[model samples]
Target: MRYSRSFIHTQYEVPKEAETPSHVLLLRGSYIYPAAAGIYSLLPLGHRVAEKIKKIIREEMDGIDGLEVTMPVLNPAELWKATKRYFDIGPELFRFRDRRQREFVLAMTHEEIVTDIAKKFLRSYRDLPVMLYQIQTKVRDEARPRAGLLRVREFQMKDGYSFHPDFEDLDRYYPRIYNAYLRIFARCGLNAVPIEADTGIMGGTGSHEFMLESAHGEDQFVVCTQCDYRANTEKAVGLKPAVKDLSANPPAMASVATPGVKTIGDLMEFFQTTEDHFLKTVAYDADGRLVLAVVRGDFNISVTKLANHLKAVHVDLASEDLLERHGLFGGFLSPVGLKDKNLRVVVDTSVGHETLYIAGGNAVDVHLKNVLPGRDFPVTEQVDIAEVRSGDTCAQCASGRLDVRRGIELGHTFKLGTKYTAPDTMDVTFLGADGANHRVVMGCYGIGVERLMASAVEQWHDEAGIIWPVTIAPYQVILSTLGKSPEVDDAADALYEALRTRWEVLYDDRDESPGVKLKDADLLGIPLRVVVSQRGLKKGTFEVKVRRTGEVFFFGRDEIEAAVARIVADLSPSLDGLPLLPEMG
Candidate 1:
């Protein structure tokens, strides 16, 4: 492609609305244009990049015996209703009424619809263990979409679903998907880490999220330095260090008037004790039932873990009216006398049975000292619902400490055991060898095409512009003709014709200055750059430069292709030195 005839637009100034590095480079490079706050229109350059990503995904999925099929983005609300996601997913689902007043949805995902299709086709166990996938568009009503492609409302995704006759078959096939996910990211020139994740709203038993660590990421995960233990913070578990026994005799329980003291800092200043000695009681509305959760003063509750434990669809802080009606003070709440209201109580695993600690005295501006669980208060349930923090003991290897890092989720795979196939959800079933009907097990895998490209930009870019990986670059080589000499232009055009036979070359034949052309080349992030200039022609060689390493080589006119191949190999050395998977010979 010649830049003179191409609709390529590169800007000098950064976009004011851009927040992250990928957003800045994508907008300034004219790869994408924002249609709305959370929606974008992919330009020619971005479209080409997205197609390359899709090709990689298709190859990997095909290698795993996946059959590609296109699913409709506009699905009837009845499909979601079968799985109860129509009501459970809340406002994020894009719902509307059609001309006939029938409700429909712009699918956030295709699990329910895909499962229904499987039920209609696969009747007996002979038709089991089939994988179907699609590369399609998905839309969600994001409340505060930002960070460019990282948090978009409408985007392209490659979602795949697998159906099996038994749990064992699904479990055996899961590792193949796991290894395939790693290969897919690696082929895209990304080093993504897979971590244990919570199956939220997907109704799955287990899940894993492929993450690319970045400073401008939305998800937080912990990676163990000692072992292979890694998980998203929402699902991560850590050991609670055992505390030493107190040396002094226990003090008698008494109430103290704490006026104008509401926070933990106030209590610390008033009593002059460490934070661990205070018990923090948090009140929440778990599916509209009031529940009191108590933990150590230094720990914060993990709401994800709490919601999973309660098995509730929604959990939020208790409203003021709900608290007042339950005879619970705003700041002073305890389990001393609320046992009559059937309020649920969940204690943290860190709290000991005989440990005496300070707690709320059930009255405003009041607190109790020397309160002991199982003695002064009833202990019903204890769980590991506290948030995992830095330096916490690792749950897998009790010796190693935990550390947290931010990451962008590029892909996810879930082991959905009977969740989508049960009688309650779509009622998908098949006959077994014994002639008995059973629920089909399922698995879901997904990759965000645009976000994958954006994550590459985020991790690979430098101060100048984007540093696209060769696998997903719009073009492999960009040939530039510098200076006003027609001889240089003629030499560049000939080289472009020759290289186009073996590579995707972008011939910059535009009447632009050398400075502007070079800056745009960097912003576009093509791997290899070939320059045909009068100075180089006088030197009896062409000037070649590697975009990522800035390595320059003067090549003879006949040695251009060999030099380009060598540099491409040096940049990426996998599967015959090609960026994407090598074609089967």
Candidate 2:
């Protein structure tokens, strides 16, 4: 590719809408152009990078005996309705009516369509296990899409699904996909950690997400200091210290006057006690129903865990009107003496049975003292809903403390079991050797192609620009002619011809200054940069600079090609030493 005829456009100033490093660099480098809020168009250089990433994904997926197949971008709404996802999912799942008045949907995922295909074929246990994958586009109506390709409503993805006869077969095959995912990321020059994650809209028994730790990430996770325990905060657990009994014999519940003291800090100061001595009751509206959640005052509630526990489609803080309609006070709310039969109350396990706590007095400007769990309020259900914090003890290792961190999800694998193939769901079945039919066990894996590309930029970039790995860079070498001398131009033209045959070369033959050409080379982030100038010609040598390290080397004209070949060979990332999975407790 020659600079004079290429479609590359770079800017000196960052765009106003750019938020993260990847977003700013990508837009300034002319790699991507925003068509809408959550939509983008990949330019020439960006398309080349995306194609390289897709090639790597194909090689890895094919290595694991995966059969490639292209699914549809539009699907019949009946397929989604068969799995009950059409109604379960909200606006994110794009739905519309065709001209014939038949309902259809834009594919957010291919699980339902794949299951429908499986039920038509694979009639016997002989075809027990098979891996099918596709590199296709997916659509989701994101409410807020930002950070370039990190979070987009429309993007390319490599989604794969596997079918097995029994749980044992699925369990045996799950590790292969996990290891492949690790190799894929490592080859892309990223060190992503696999952490246990929650199965959100995709109902499954277990799931793990590959995360690359970044300060600008949207997801928060925890890692053990002494062990290999890692999990997203929404699904993480911690070991709680046992609460000591405040008194030898618990005292009876009594009312206390707390005028104008509504907040936890105020109540703690009024009673001269710690935060754990009080009960914090929060009201929520889960699927249009009122729910009361109680936890120790020192802990905050995780809305993700609360919604998952209640199996609610949506959960948010209850409004004042909703609470008042249920006869529940905002600051003085309690689970005890509730008259509404439809109200649901859930308590966190941190509220111990023996510890006496100060709870709401069910009235304004008042509180109850010496309130017990089972004695004062009924123990209908108890679970862990407290958010994990830094310095908390690890639940698995018990001896290690957790360190909270932020990361971006690069890939995710789910052990779906029969969630989509059960009789009550998609009803995908196969005949077994025992002359009976059974639901096929399954697993799904996905990697966002654009997200991976952006994450690589996020993980490996400097003030100059993105430092692309050699394997996935748009071009391996950039040849620039520094001076207007005809001698330098002749030398650079010859070098471009000689290198283009053996390597991916981008020749800068434009009528631009040396400073502008050099800065553009660095901004493009080619692995090796070759310079031909009159000064260097006088020295009987050519200049070579490594973009990643900024190290310059001078080689004789005859040895320039060999030097570039060797450097490019060394720049490719290797995955020989990576483990299949990180250590786990």
Candidate 3:
């Protein structure tokens, strides 16, 4: 490809909306163009990189006995309705009416469509385990699409689903996909850490996410310092240190009049005590039902954990009207007098049993002292719903402390145990060896193609521009002809022809200055740059510069191809001796 004829445009100024490094460089380098607020069009350069990523993903998926198949992006609404996801997923799922007024939905995922296929085929025990995968487009009406491809409404994804005879078989086959995911990310020049994650909307028993730690990432996770325990904040758990009782001998609950003292901070200041001596209550509207969540003052509630506990589709803060209708106060709310109320009550495990603490008095400018759980108020439900923070004790090892970090999620794997294959759902079944029909267990794995591409840029770029890895770079080598001498031009043309036949070489045959050509080469992020200049040619040699290391080597006129081959070999990511999983303590 020649720069003069190619659709390549480099910008000098960054766009105002480009916040992350990948977003800024991709736009300035002309790799992607914003089509809408959350949609983008991949230019020629970006398309080439995407193709390379797809090729790598295909190879890895095929190695695991996965059969490639293309599912339609437009799916009938009846399939989703059968699976009950049509009503469970809210505005994020794109739904519309067709010409005949029939309902349809854009494919946010293919779980329902694939299960429908499995129901039609795979009749016996012999077809117990089968894997199907596809590299296709997915659509989600994201409310806040920011940071370029990292969070987009429409993007490319490689989603795979496997059906098995039983839970035992699915559990055994899960590690193969896990190891394959590690290799795929390593080959793409990313160090993604695997962490336990919540199965949001997927409705799975367990799941894990592959993440790359970065400050620009939107997801937060915690890592143990002494053990192998790691999890996303939405599902993370920590060992809470035991707290002593506020009072040695328990006293009866008593309410005191306090003027203008409503918040926990105000109560703490008025009593001159620590926050741990108080109880905090929060009200939420979980799927139109009022839920009062109680936790210790030192801890905060995790909304994801709360929603999962109630099995609700949508959870938001409860309105004042909703709370007042149930005779609950805004600033002073408690579960003391709500034992027979129509709403649900959830108490965090952090609120110790038989321990006296301060609590809401259920009246204006009033609070209760000597409040105890199971003695003064009914303990309806007790669960772990507090947010895990940095420096907390590790739940797995108990000796290690946790470090909270932010990262970008590159891939996810889920163990779905008959969630979509049950009789009430898709009804996908297979004949077992015992002459009985049984529901097929399932597992799903997905990798965001564009998100992976953008993550590579985020992980590898420097101050100059993007530093793409050799495996996924648009072109491996860039040949620039500096100066207007006929000899230099002829030499560069011959070298370009020799290299194009064997490798992906971009020839900068445009009439541009040396400074502009070199700057553009850096911005494009080709791994190797081969220069044929008048000064170097007169000295009976040419120059080769490595993009990653910034190392320069001078070679004879006839040594361009050999030097390039050797340098590219050294710059490539090696798969030799790669571990399937990280070392555990």
C-alpha lDDT of residue 154 in model 3: 99
Clashing pairs in 3: none
lDDT per residue as tens, model 3, 1-585:
998999999998999999999999999999999999879999999999999999999999999899999999999999999989999898999999999999999999999999999999979999879999999999999999999999999999999999999998888888889888988998898888999999999988999999999999999999999998989999999987767764577789998898988667789998787898788899999999999999988999999999999999899999999988888888888888774466788999899885678888888788898888888888979999899989999999999999999999999999988999999998888999999989899999999999999999999998889888999999999999989988998888888889998889999999999999999999989999999999998898889999999999999967877888898888888766654653222
Model 1 C-alpha lDDT per residue in residues 1-585, reported as the tens digit of each score:
999887789988988899999999999888999999989999999999999999999999999889999999999999899888898887999899999999999998999889989989988999989999999999999999999999999999999999998888888788888877888888888878889999988868999999999999999999886787889999999887655454467667789999998889989989888787778888999878998888888788888899999988888999989988888887898766574557898988877765677899888888998887777788888998888988888999888888899999999999988888888889988898899998889999999999998999998888888888888899999999889887997888889999999889999988889998999999998888898999999998998888888888999978989888878777772543222222221
Candidate-wise lDDT, in order: 0.88, 0.91, 0.91
Residue 231, model 3: lDDT of 97
Report model 1's TM-score to 2 decimal places: 0.97
The TM-scores, one per candidate, come to 0.97, 0.97, 0.97
Specify the poorest-scoring 10-residue window by lDDT in model 1: 576-585
| Model 1 residue 24 CA deviation in Å | 0.4
Candidate 2 CA-lDDT value = 0.91
Model 1 lDDT on a 0 to 1 scale: 0.88
Candidate 3 lDDT score relative to the true structure: 0.91
| TM accuracy, model 3 | 0.97
Each candidate structure's count of clashing pairs: 0, 0, 0
